[model samples]
Target: MPWNWTQAEWPNFHYDRAPLERLEQQFLVASGEILGAVRHVSGEDRERLRIDLLSEEAMRTSAIEGEMLDRSSVQSSLRRHFGLGVDIASARPREQGIAEMMVEVYSGFAEPVTDESLCRWHGMLLSHDRGLDMIGAYRRHDEAMQIVSGRIDRQTVHFEAPPSVRVPAEMRAFIDWFNRTTPDGLSPVPALTRAALGHLWFESIHPFEDGNGRIGRALAEKSLAQNIGQPSLIALAYTIERDRRRYYDLLETHQKTLDVTPWILWFGEAVLEAQQVTLARVAFLIAKAKFYDVHRAHLNPRQAKVVERLFRAGPDGFEGGLSAENYIAITGTSRATTTRDLQDLVERGALTRTGERRHTRYRLPI
Candidate 1:
């Protein structure tokens, strides 16, 4: 019965500065700890962590939109982006496009956010799937927009964006606020706060006909990158996906009120949680580095490839390790050769052997 936050007269939003300031401080401290943990890793591990983190971010962000991407394809695109040569498999066009968008976003972290830049990002996102009927363009004035779900006969309206006529001017103002400084006719706001507010503002605008969710998340990533002075390892989208219902509810409630403190708080908490998860995952990178250091020189090609898969398997690493059949399948080796190789690895202390005869299996010692 009433206007949404954006549609209200003089809807200028504000929040409790004290709480946001505290959250920003906490975020910075958590980021600092992650940086310290990262610095202790070897250069190779650091690079791998960077690639792996971004790959996860890209894949998880797309997953939030209900799109399941092939992890290898996404990783291939990322590998090529870093000049790290593609793996055995090639990336699909859609995967390549998403990878390109992420690389560009991280590369341009220091630049100001602009409408044109946002459009370009949208184009890259939709390039592979041209059937989306729109390409990096704003919505048409005649198209009615609403976030709806459920059966057509039982439709539920979650939110409605501002009319198409207001999009251009709304975006212009948002961008100006984003780029402006403390003395530029605006109050001084912490960079992290700006990042959180920017995310909320962009999503509320819902400027594009499609890809708004992904683009909005990317914009938030941009803010975190610019403010933190590093591309983020925090996969906020992953956290959102894990709690999608609450994420949507937060947006719905905040967009209807002028006070956005709750939304900002929720975002900050989510970021902290994501970074903590990343820190735990960093253990894999560290272990990987150590594993390769001790075994690379001793391992044959087949053994090396098999070791990679075992390590990648994490805690779920095959029950009783990998059998000769699994090893042969992975390395294209003969059953006899696989047996001999596994025996040699055990003798070399590179792997541990369990069971006897055909029931035997091999696993990384480390």
Candidate 2:
């Protein structure tokens, strides 16, 4: 069967916007709520939230493409990009590249979608890689750009993009469509609708030799931020990463037809879910600040160090909860001291204890 891009309708995507009307309004309402919550955050905490969300995005987006980046390295790279002080000497090239691309998407969302801009983002995304026939430019190879699985002898072709000869023209039209459909453009599309369509449209093109998924997601975010008039802090990549199989299935299923109402609806709901996750994260940050304020005086030096470490793990709390051994490793205190500190933290309501004896684990009261 011919791919959606090869259909007669081709770039003229058709979706039932009626179903998405309520979702679009919900997205805008959630966006306003998030902004209001963010405004209540102090400056220091707000900057920290930005770095956390960006780092999470960079890490999650890359992970979706089967690349595992160091969280600290990505965070350090993002901090440096924001002109904040950070020890970024340990950051590798891959982490640095994605971090740079993410910052560009966030800061330059309002810029027109031009080939030069896209290529710049492509360059930054693949700056460290040495293996591709093309780096900053679109794929020019004659062989089919196919997403396949299984062994070479018995591979399954999931999807094949438009041929290389057609990429330049396809992308030119795509860039034009992207700009003209912006909220303030000659033809304004709704925020969620445009973002969902932009992502699906770019992924269908798969213009580049590599990094298409990552860049497509970035484009979606840029669309959202452009409509909302701010850097969209929605955890889109993080949310998608949670149910990756379904995400791919939906994309594959939708790529076969121009009637993409299902895809648009799914994408809209995903963005809404991502927004709620981000709001929870902001609320967590606020709770963290209040937790520190209330417990700071009662925590001893050792307890304070351990508590700080736990809070650094974010809203989920430390993974598997904090064990006594973990406490010793963090504080370098003796077993007796560890026991004393843990009990004191539990007594002061700074931490909640579960299980007993060897199975004991502690988590933040919040």
Estimate the TM-score of every prediction.
0.83, 0.97
Candidate 1: count the clashes.
0
Off by over 4 Å in 1: 1-3, 6-11, 181-188, 297-303, 314-366
- Clashing pairs for predicted structure model 2, backbone only: none
Q: Rate the local accuracy (lDDT) of all candidates.
A: 0.80, 0.93
* Residue 272 miss distance in model 1 (angstroms): 0.7
Write candidate 2's Cα lDDT for 83-133 as tens digits.
Answer: 998783567899999999999999998898899889899999998889988
* lDDT for each residue of candidate 1 in 1-366, tens digit (9 for 90 to 100): 233545555247778888777778888888888888898788877777777778878888898889988888988998898898878979898888888888888888768878889999998888876566668878865666788899999998888888788888889888888777321325546656776788788887888888889888888887776677777767788788888889889988877776788888888888878878787767666766777778789998999889888877753478767998999889998988987888888888888888888788777765
Give one clash count per candidate, in the order shown.
Answer: 0, 0
